[model samples]
Every structure is written in structure tokens, then in C-alpha cells.
Target: MRMDWTALPEAVTKEVANRIDGSRVLPATAGDHAEIAATVAGARGKVFVKAARTELGVRSLRYELRVSEAVSGSHSPAVEWHFEAAGWLVVAFEHCEGPHADLSPGSTDLGLLAATLQDLGGTPAPDARLFVPSERFGFAHPAMDGDRLVHTDLTAANLIVTTQGLRIVDWAMATEAAPWVELAALVAWLIGAGHTPEQAEQWLAQHSAWHEVDPAVLTFFALRNAEKWALKSRQGSAGWMHDLADWTGQWAAYRRRPAN
Candidate 1:
């Protein structure tokens, strides 16, 4: 149900055009998502627009908008304007320009990402009923319960390498959980980026948030992550999904091994 920006209903386009003070809408090439996205060029400047036309899109975009509004700053985009009419919800953001993070083992972008994660961890989790990672993983451990605002999806694609620094976007899957949760997820991503499981943990461990987590809890989390990804990988999805699942599975196995 993805609609091009130019093809969007007249009402939705009109609203966006008014907000950006633009006379025309130039739709960006679609990504793998269920929403209409584009950049509108106006007299003032250009602003990015993402709109949801379906019920699922509405719910997802609403959550994304909420998180964007909650954590307003350079790290996250601010919602310039938002409106819902004719069964469509739209929000405009200050366009962040840059390529996705280069997560290769020795890439400098990793340093920037470290800084970004540190800042995000310090940001208080919004006072909303966000999904808890512990519940999603069915972990009975108490360590998983805390009020840290975690991006959850820490893949390279989610981190944009902008001039200021690395910025985490795609808040649609954000959740409230332990401060160390994101670090744990990054461990898997790092492995996917060609770092050994041990090296990944070593790199993320430099962050203070990772220090706050206990060893036993981390072990449990690794086990659960391996289980989740392993199941998904078995479903026969090709490419990154399967590759990431393998990477996470490797990290879990590494955790299970006896320390020298």
C-alpha cells in the first residue's frame, strides 16, 4: 500500500506543501517500508515527509512520531508538523543527510556511533507504555527491567553518518528496557560487521552503560537473542536477515563457551 509522494491524495500533499512552504513535492525513492516518503522542496528549505495511510502504518508512524517528539534534538529529528485527515497521518522532519554507518570492524564510524549510543542512553525513556524487551524475549530475570530509552534496531542502516555525528533514526521499533540493552544488540551487529564476538563485546564494553550490566544477565540475554534469531533464520529468509541471525547466533555460542 505504499504510495508515492506525488501520487498521494491531494489533501495530504496540500498539507505537506503548506508546512514546508513548498510549491512541489519530490518523492524519494521508496525503501523497504510500508509508508509514503519524500522530500518537499519549498521557498524556505527542503523537509522530509513520511506518511501512513493504513491502520498498521498509522500505528507505526504514530509511535515513530511520538519517539521523535519525545527525544527532540540533533540526535533525533524534530517533527515540524503533523496532521491526520482523509485517513492519512503525516509528519515532516528536518532532513538528515548522509549515508548509513560503515560498520566494518575498523571503520571510524564506530567511534561516532559509540558517542551517539552514550548520549541516547543518558536520555530518559519517554513516559509512555513502550514495549519492554524482557517481555518480548520472555525473560523472567529482573535485570531486564529498567527505564532506558533503547533504539533496539541498531543496524548500520539505522545510524546515519551526518556532519555533526552519528544519529539513530527509525524509532518505529524503539522500546523501554535496561540501559545496557542497546550495547548487547550492538554486540551482534558488530559481529556482523566482521568483528569477532569477543571483540564486539570488548568494544561496546567501553561505554559506561555496558558496565552497569551484570555478567549473569548478559549471558541470559545472549541466549535469548540467539534463540530469537535462530528461529527466524530457520524460516529461510535470505540476505541480511539470515546473515544477522547467523551473526547473533555466533555471539550467543561464544557466550556459552567456557572462558579461558
Candidate 2:
């Protein structure tokens, strides 16, 4: 996924410049995603450009663009435009400068994450209903859905710690789901980020959305996510993926069999 700005086709570079009205482009190799990524600078403006030329890359770009278009919030970076240029799928986002969020236990950013999620949970889901988590993952306990949009991929890499506050980036996994559902879904990532099952629960308890969730609903999501992670672990992933699957299972186990 790492690629230099100069590596892009000249046609793409030209279109990118046209999009931002920029003449100078500097490569920004910060993210794990984006094939032709850089900071386009010139008289018109400075913006972050992300693009990909592969079929899957184009498809993924469209998904993210649509999802990004669905929400407008302080938690999200403002996107300038999304379009195809010289056979490359591309999008330009307002250039935001900050380090990725630190979600490790006890970090101040964790509170900021809570605030951001709270704000995001309040936003209604996009009207098009492009995807439905209920239909996707049929929890044995039945679906608990509402109009709220959910960002399923809330990894540290996707979060930015800005002077204003915590902002979430990357909406490729956005889907229609209950806000409380997202609260429940966040537990595994919390565990993966070094929160003990107990600590994660304590943190989740502070959120009003989690308070409204029925115990069975929480159990259903935990069990379902556990199963999903279990399968993902078997797919030959290493390191964090492997550890995530294990941590998620352990957290589910704790939830299933509470301490005496």
C-alpha cells in the first residue's frame, strides 16, 4: 500500500492537481491504506490525496467515499471530493495534521474516543441503507437495529488525535446499525488495545448507550463477534490479528462466565 506520489501516472497527477488546484505534491507515507497518497500543495489549496488503481482498490475507494459522504461531524475529516481520474479511483480530504490516536489502557485519548463515539452515535444512519449489519450477522438473539450509522472499523490506525479533539478517519466499514450495537462491538477493540475485560466493561459502563442495551443483546454481539474473530484467526493472519482473535475470545469468555 506504500507508494510515492511520483509513482502515480502523470495523468492521475495532473487530475489530482486540477482537483486541488495545486502544482506541488509531497508524498505522505503515513497510512497503511491508499496506493497513491500525498499532500498536494499549491496556490489553490493543500489537501490530502488518496487513490488506488487496482480493481479492488477502486471498489474499496468507492465504498469509503460513499460512507464518508453519509456523515458530517467533528469526528470526521471533511472530504473535498471523490472521483475517478485517469483510471485511478481517488478522493481528496481536508489535510489534517495530528498523530494517530493512542487507545492503550489509561491513555487520555480513550476518553476522547468515548466522546467521539458518543457524538458519532447520535448521527442518524445514511438514507441509502447501503449495508445492514442485522442482515449481515444474524445474531441468534435477533437483530437490535436503529437508524444510527455505525463505523465497524474503529482501530487505532483509523483514529486521529488532534488539538481540537479525537477524530475518526476511514469509513470503509460504515453500515446501518444500532448505536448501542456499536457500543457493544467496540469491546473487542478495547480489549485488543490493552484493556482488561473488567476494565473494558467498566469503561463501557460509563456510556449511556451501553446502559440502555439489554444484557442478552450485549451477549449476542460478543458471541457473534467472537465467532467472527475465531474464523479470521484461522485464516493465517499473524501478530495483531492473531492476538485480537485471542483477546476477543477471552473477553467473550469472561462475559459468558462471569466471576463467582
Candidate 3:
């Protein structure tokens, strides 16, 4: 079931109208269960609007607001400010300008993203109870150290290349977890995208300080993610399922090879 924005309570819409000075609104990008776009008032400048109604989503938005406030002075791009009113979480951010599709992985822009992640990891937010234990440890591993906050959903859609560099947009799934685990997940994503294990390892080693963790962990996470993608593909597109099957066969063959 999808959320219908028009069904939102009247009180929420009025609150949003009051926060931003203008009534003019434009349709923006839409995510799994939310719609995001830019808003403007009469000469007051622009702000971001994110509206959703799912219970989990509301929790995530509230947490993101806290994290954004906590890291405001740190200069990290992962953080953004959001407010809750009229049953919607309307967020105001610096109107950043950039075309979204052009920012791809492995491009020079990724360097800035890497730096942002590094800074976010380095900032210790021990008191932030934004992420529950189960949600934080559920994805990659069974046991998480719970040391740092991680932007768990780091997909291409969530990354925006702005004038300042790169900024991560979605914060609903961000949670506190072991830093290495999140890094491992990123490495896994790189490997699944066709990078050799060695190449992925080298890339992570150069990118983050917590690169000494077992490489086997990264491979495990990658395989897990691959299986999930394959299952989803089987449901959505036959061609994707076929490609995933072929990739799985190649992965098995590579796994059987002796270490050099």
C-alpha cells in the first residue's frame, strides 16, 4: 500500500503552508514511500519538503532531524534539518544545485562522498538513540558493536551532487552501527557491481581507516546482497533474474579457485 499525500490531515498541510511563506508547490522526486521537492516563498528563498505517513518513516524522519542538528557544525553532507508538522516532515535545507543522474560511483565526485562518510564516521554520537538495536544489527551481521551512525541506504538515488560537492538525501534508514560493518557493506556493493574482490579491498583500504576487518565479512555481505537482488529480480524482471543466475555461476567458479 502506497501513501497518498492528498489524504494527509488538513492540519498538517496548513502547518506546512505556515512554515514556508508561499503557496506555490512543485512536484519533486519520489522515493519508496515519500515525495521530496523544492519549495519557495515570495523572495524568502527555497527549502526542501519531504512528506510521508508510515510509522517507521515518521520515526526515521525524527531521528534524521536530531542527527542533522547534532552534526550541523561538523560540515558533513549526510546531515539535513527536518521539522514535523501537519502530519508531514517538512525539511529545510540549503538550496543545493546539481543534476542528480550525473553523479555515479567511481567518478571523481565519489571522492567527496567518501570524505563525507569519513567525517560522519569520525564524529562520535554515542547518545543518539535514533536507531534501535534490532534495526541497526539486522542488515549485515547478527552482532553489531553499535559504535557509530551509518547511512544504511546509500543507493545512487539517495546521493545528490550539489555545488558544495555531494550530499546524501534520504535519512530514514540511517542508524547507529559499527563503522566497519557499514564500510563492509559499501565494499560489498562495489564487489557486486563487478569489481574484483582484490580491487574492492584495495579501494576500501584507500578510502577508510577501518579497513583491517576480515575480507571474508565483506564477501559474505556481498553474497547476501546478491541473493536478495536476485530474488527481487526474479519477481520483477526475467532478464535480471537470468543475469543474476549467470553472475552467481561465475562467482561460484571464482570462489573455487586457489588463492594466489
Candidate 4:
């Protein structure tokens, strides 16, 4: 959830200070999760820093750090440094400068994002405790099974549109799933970004890997995703959960529509 950057504990601040020379902490207004999210600039350059003290938050951050280490290629920003300070686990990554990807129709970012996803699909799944589609969506099909790692969270916010191409951030929700699941998960975002369901699928068809997913699996994913987001929005409606609930519901309904 979007949160104001409060002053860090003196000891925590001091510890972070000791690590980066002439560091300046700038508050971050984006991102849904993270206890402390900010940009730290110093002698070297800017690094996006995310720190967490809560047990769940710390564990998630550590897992993401591990995943980041295993992931290679220019698609993801490199990890800068990470350390524990004042009981909080702080991790930093190369601060990539760019706006969140534009998924709307007619945006050039669509191609860049597609290329990035294709590149990321080639990264082998690291030896880690990873979530399967059923573990996350409560329903899984044979088509969802694969050895390749996929970034389950395809929200535009996680995709930075840099000059070189799109750079994906936040590996906290990365999962082990079929390559197609990566693009399948992006359908809702396309709808949310103003594409009709048919249009979204047409765009997805441009990728050869997308042709491999079973149509039944897409329908199942849409149903479960709609249900999942709806439940979460009811519990806590902030931080784009409600938006996702709406978009997923729309996609599901569109998929269920009768043949014209």
C-alpha cells in the first residue's frame, strides 16, 4: 500500500548511513508491498531500497533477494546490496529510471513488454521453494505445470519502460509455471488498460508461446483470478485490489460470453 516515508529509527538510519557514503533517502510513493520503500542516492548512484521489519515482510523480501540473485539478463535490474540493520532486512537494487509500462492500446511499450516476458521465460527456475499455480490460484491444470520460472505479478507498475526496453522489478510473487502462464496473467492488465477482451487475446496471440496454452486453462485462470481478487478486495479494498477485482471479473465474463 502507498505509505508516507516516516523517519527511520536512529540506529537503523545510522546503520544505513554507514553503508552508503553521502546517502540521501527519498520517499517512494509507489508499490503495494514493503514496510520501507525508498530511493537511496549516494556516491555511486541511485538504488531502489526496500526494507521490512515484520516477520512476513522480512521473509518475503529475503525470498525476493534470493530470486533476484538467481535471475540473470538485462530484463531485471541488478541487485546493488543488501544487509540487516536495526532488526530490519534492507535490500537495494539498481534504480532503473522509467515510467511504469503503458499497456493501453497503441502503446509501443506493448512490444517491449512482450520481449521482456519472452526473455524472462528463458531463465531457468532456481532451486527454491516456489509456488505452483494451484498454490496461488486455488485451482491448477496440467497446462500450468512447467519448469520455467514466471513472474506471476504482471502489473504495469512492476514493468518499467526504460530506453533499452522494459525492466521488470519485484520478484516477490515469482512462481514456477508454464511459459504461457506469464502472458495469460497479463490479459487482465490489458483489459484494465482499456483493451477489449478480444483485443487483448489478439495481442497475446502475437507471441508463439501463447499459442501453446490450452484455452481451457485460460478460462480457468480467469475464473480463479476474478474470484481471488474479489475476495481480497472485500477483505482490504485499497492498493489496486478492487481495480484488479473489477478487471478480472470483466475478463472472466468476456471469456464466458456466448459465441457471436
Candidate 5:
């Protein structure tokens, strides 16, 4: 269901407008159960807003706000600020220009993205309070360290390359997870887009440390992500899901097989 911004609690709308220097507000895009992507006029910047009417949505929105706040000042370029007023949570961020007409695993954009993740390794974990429990790891590996703040959801739509550098937008699903988790997710995403395993491995080799992690561990995370999209595909959830399940099952079986 799409939210009518005009009907948003006046205070929430006012706060968002005021933060953007009173820019003319225009709707940008809507996703899943949230309405987002608003352009702020004067500075020509954009702010993304999410409002939820259901109990689950409200809980998730709160979690997103917390994650945004936790990673705010870290070197990672994520959502800048979050404000809650009148039953809405608004996050303001510097807008990024183009995803470019062409974006792929081998694009220079991916190179820049890899470089950004490499730099994030140096960012200090802000506070322990923001640490989400291990079981809350989502797509991240449960055994991986949660010290560094992670974007968790680094899908193509969330990234944009601007004159400055790569800017990651959309923090609704961001969380603190293993540093390699982001890298693993990126690799998995490339595979799902049809890049061959060899190609994915080559791309991942660019980040040597991340590549050195147990291949099975990395593949497990990758396969889990693949199963998620498979479930959502229109072709029929069972087939795609089964394909991933079978691939993993076969991998497990082969790992346990006796030496030939």
C-alpha cells in the first residue's frame, strides 16, 4: 500500500522539509511496503522517508533508524541523520546522481565499491549498545565478527556513483555484521546476475583477505542469498528454491564423500 505523504503527520513532514533547507518536495520512489525517495529543492539534494502502518513495519522502521544512527559518523557513507516525529521516521542524506546506464560486476563502479568496503575496515565500532545479537545476523554469517558497522543490504539499487565517489543510499536494512559479510553479499549478488563462478571468484580475489575466508563459508552465505531471490522469482518459488537447495545439498554431500 502506498502512503499519502500529504496525509503524513504534519510534524514529520515539517521536520523533513525543514532539514532539507525548505526544498520543494517531490516523491521519488516507493518500494515494498514503504514510500521513499523525495527530492529536496534548494540544495538539489534528496532525502528518503519511510512510514509504516502495520505493527511489523513499525518495528522494522525503528530498527532501521537505530542502525542509521549507529553508523552515522563512521567513515562509511550511509544515511546521515534520522528523526522521528508524529509517527514517522525520516532520514536525510546527501543525494547521489547516477547509477549509470550500465552497471555490472565488472564495471569500474564495482571497483570503486570494492575500494569503499576496503576502507570501511578501518572505521571503529561506535558503541556496543548498537550491537545487534548474533541471531539477528540476517544474511550475514553467524560466526562472523559484528564489530564493524555493515550496510548488509548492498544491492545494486542502493548504490550510486557521483562526482565525489560511490554513495550508498537506503539504510532501512543496514546492520552491524562481519566486515566480510558485505563483501560476501556483493559476490553473491554478482553470481545471481549471471556472472560465472570463475568470474565471481576473480572479482572477489581483488579483496584478497575476504577471498581467503573458507570458500564453503562464503558459498553458504552466497547460496542463502540466492535462495531468497529464488523464492521471489515469478517462475515459481519451488523450482528456483529447490535448485539452490539441491546445489547446497550436493555440495555438502561432495564435501563428505571419501577421497577418490
Candidate 6:
């Protein structure tokens, strides 16, 4: 859905120009979501902007802005401003410069990422209405209840490795769930980064949150996530979604293996 500045409506472009002082657009990375993703250079400085015209996209971006504002700046980029213009919902965030985190095995980025997650675990969910794991996933579980804010999308692309530290982006999928949910989400990312499911869990076990939850619950989460991703992939989602389905399936399989 990524689009260049020229793709925006004339009215939208004019509004953006006013907000940023001047408009020099550098289209952001091509992500599956966000119709207008770009870094705008202004007389003030650069600000990353995400704008959407579709109803779903607009709602998602607005919700993301709300959830993102609630998160501490240490964990996410600061929201500079947001407004609606000519049917587009646009939000600007402090421009963070860095490549995405390297999740491959033995990468130093793991430590930075782990620290960010640890800090996030301590961050309380915003008072604003947000989805809890059960509601978000459409399955009830007592273990899914918690007050901590959870960013379910832990893909490397969303984890910007800035000099300040690892700053997580894309809060559209943010949830208020148990501290363990984020760790659970990380398992699939590790698998995609070339770690076997067992190896991923082994690494995750070093964290306290991993042990706070029942192993049975983790297995259930893995199975449910795998089913969700697989269904999405089958339903004509992006081709890369198949990789998510595969990674989550591997984790579920590992968890379901009989104890020796």
C-alpha cells in the first residue's frame, strides 16, 4: 500500500506541506500496511509520516497513534503531530534513523532487543481502550489477562536499531496482554531468523516472563497463532504471510512434542 507523495490528493499534499514547514518527501520502506508512508524533511527537521485514505487504514493509523502516544519514548518514536486532511488520517513521528534490527543468530542486536522488551514489560497499558489477547485473538483464556502493553508485531522491520537503542514501531497491533505474549510473539521471529523452534524457546527461557506462564498456555498460543497466520496466508494475504504461518507452525509443533 505504500505510495509516493504524488499519489496523495492535492488537498492532502497541501495540508502536509503546512504541517511540516516544507515538503521534501522520501518514501519510507515498502510495508504491507500504510498507504502513505514517507519521511518528510522540513525546515524544522525530518518527521516520519503515515497517512491513509481507506476506512480500515484510517482507523488503524488513528488507533496506532493513540496506542503509540501512550508508550514511553524509550520504547517508541515520539509522535510529533497528527491531523486529518481531505479524508486522509496522517500522523507524524520523530524521525528515527537506523536499519532494522538484525535478528539472525549470534547478532548483537538480540541484546538490545531483549532490553527493549524488558522495558516494555514494565510499561503499563494506556488507560485508553485497547484489545486484550483474548479479545484480539477471539479466544478466551484466563492466562491472557494482564495490564502490560504488548506489541504483537515484533518483526525486525518494526524494530529500528537506532543509536539511542531499539525503538519499536507499528503500534497498530498493540494489545494489552500478559507480559508473556510479547515473548511468545518473539519465538516466531527467532524461528524466521534461522533458529529452530527448540533453540528459540531455549533462548526465550532465559527471560523471566517465559517461565511465568504455563507451558500449556504457551502451546495453545502457538497453535492459535499458527492457525491465524495459516488462514490469512490461505485467504490471499501477502506471500510473506506464508512464512509467518510456517514459523508459528514450527513453534506449535515443537511445543506439542511429547515430553521424553
Candidate topping TM-score: 6
Q: Is candidate 2 or candidate 6 better by lDDT?
A: 6
> Mind giving the per-residue lDDT tens digits that candidate 3 earns over 1-260?
33444665777666656666555655455455354444444345455665655677666556666666555423334333455665576665554456552323466755765777777676565465667435543444644456676776555556667776677665666677667655655553454466665565566676554564554555555466556656667677555355554554344334345551
lDDT of 4 by residue, 101-169 (tens): 989999998988877777877777878877788885677888899988888888888888887778899
Candidate 6 lDDT, tens digit per residue, 1-260?
66677888888878778887889989876466788899998787899999998988888898889887877758788999988878889899988899998998899999998788788888889877788787677665789889999988888989898888888888888899899988998899899999999888888887899999988888888888898888988997576889998998998888888860
**Rank ordering of all candidates by lDDT, starting from the highest:** 6, 4, 1, 2, 5, 3
lDDT of 5: 0.58
Backbone clashes, candidate 5:
1
- Residues 41-83, candidate 1: write the lDDT tens digits: 8887877788887788888889888878887556786777789
TM-score of each: 0.88, 0.86, 0.71, 0.93, 0.71, 0.95
Candidate 2 global TM-score: 0.86
**Candidate lDDT values, in order:** 0.78, 0.76, 0.56, 0.82, 0.58, 0.85
Candidate 5: which stretches are off by over 4 Å? 1-4, 7-11, 18-23, 30-33, 42-46, 72-83, 100-105, 128-142, 192-194, 223-260
Give one digit per residue, the lDDT tens place, for model 2 in 1-260: 66777777788778877766776877875455567777788777888778888887777777777777767878877889877757888898877778878878889888888888888888898765446775545453445667788887787877888788887877766778778777776777788888888888888887788878787767767777788778878996656668768877977888797541
RMSD of each: 2.5, 2.7, 4.5, 1.8, 5.0, 1.5
Clashing pairs in 2: none
Candidate 4 lDDT = 0.82
lDDT for 198 (candidate 3): 59
> What TM-score would you give candidate 6 relative to the actual structure?
0.95
Model 6: pairs clashing at backbone N, Cα or C within 3 Å: none
Model 1 TM-score is: 0.88
